[model samples]
Target: MKGRFWPKARLGDVTCVMGTNGVGKTSLLRAISGTHPRSSGDVTFDGKPLGQMNAHKMAQMGVGYVPQGRDIFPLLTVRENLQTGFSCLPKSEHFIPDEIYQLFPVLKEMQTRRGGDLSGGQQQQLAIARALITKPKLLLLDEPTEGIQPNIIQHIGEVIRLLRDRGDMAIVLVEQYFDFAFDLADRIVVLRRGEVIENAAKQDIAREQLLSIVSV
Candidate 1:
């Protein structure tokens, strides 16, 4: 799968890729996260080509991926779902961080609830929380706000802002919602047919400008 409409390019702090449906946003993430291997091009981390690594290797190297559609274990309890990230860590460091719960308190209250029992927003939160437990350096989120409610969206935005402000992590977001992506992204990447059309900082482009890129 290749980026449609939106070209592949780099942005500041964030290498965001945006476009309409079927633009391959999810596929770009899949390639970067190593879920689907890239046909070419180099995905480098700390100056190393990511193509040389595997999924587990990528995680260990600090890339946390929260894919599209909130892929949580429907039957698994919230706690168990979080525990899944433990595989990315060594035995000594294998424990869900307290910050994870602090970041998404709803998860604390619904600890015993099955992932599928939660609403779409709650499931999305759980899915993100599960990723945060891994303590990634480069967090890859694919349409995190998709199908989520407004309040939850705000919370997620704050969380993302906090993570970015920390300055230790690099975030790559794939989004269709202009306002949502614009607000959270330090920079934006516009996709238009497996190619990067525009990549610039938030301060560099206005809302209308972004809308024009996504409008097909």
Candidate 2:
């Protein structure tokens, strides 16, 4: 994840990371989430320096990561899968919130169903809901729209917007879908060969210019 950097993200804003495949977009997220080791540099959250912490430690510190591929427990029921997020919470906060169901109603209906039984989009929704269970201050989403249907993508986009409008958390979204990312981003960071070629406010860059940069 070297040579990749962006400005500090403020709460209530969406920062979209876009690039061609193999440009370390996912790796960048892994570094932030502490799912992968950070060889160098520092990551600070809420004005505190997070130096070489593990995934669990980061989660405890309010970093919620929904990685690519919707990695849900196949044998676990939808409710069970979400309950896994409780591991990062205190005993008093072990119960799932009604807002989780409110955000994704389909998960409420499939509460008892196994995660593997759900479609790709359903699994994606479950993955996101599970992350929200931690009530994270920083949410990292990697390719949420990948392999998802148009309708679900739109739903997810709306959810992201709602979450942003809530002004409670900061979101870092890694996406390859051009228009989808562009439409939701408050700021844009474009990467190439693990290097950041462009980083600017959404209003500062034209859509066509960004499309040309990533397309190259």
Residue 185 displacement (Å), model 2: 0.3
TM-score of 2: 0.98
Clashes of each: 18, 0
- Per-residue lDDT, model 1, residue 14, is 61
Off by over 4 Å in 1: 1-12
TM-score for every candidate vs. truth? 0.91, 0.98
Q: Which pairs of residues collide in candidate 2?
A: none
- Residue 139 of model 1 has an lDDT of 87
lDDT of 2 by residue, 1-216 (tens): 445466887899999999999998999899999999988878999999989999999999999999999899999999999999999999999999999999999999999999999999999999999999999999999999999999999999999999999999999999999999999999999989988899999999999999999998
lDDT of 1: 0.81
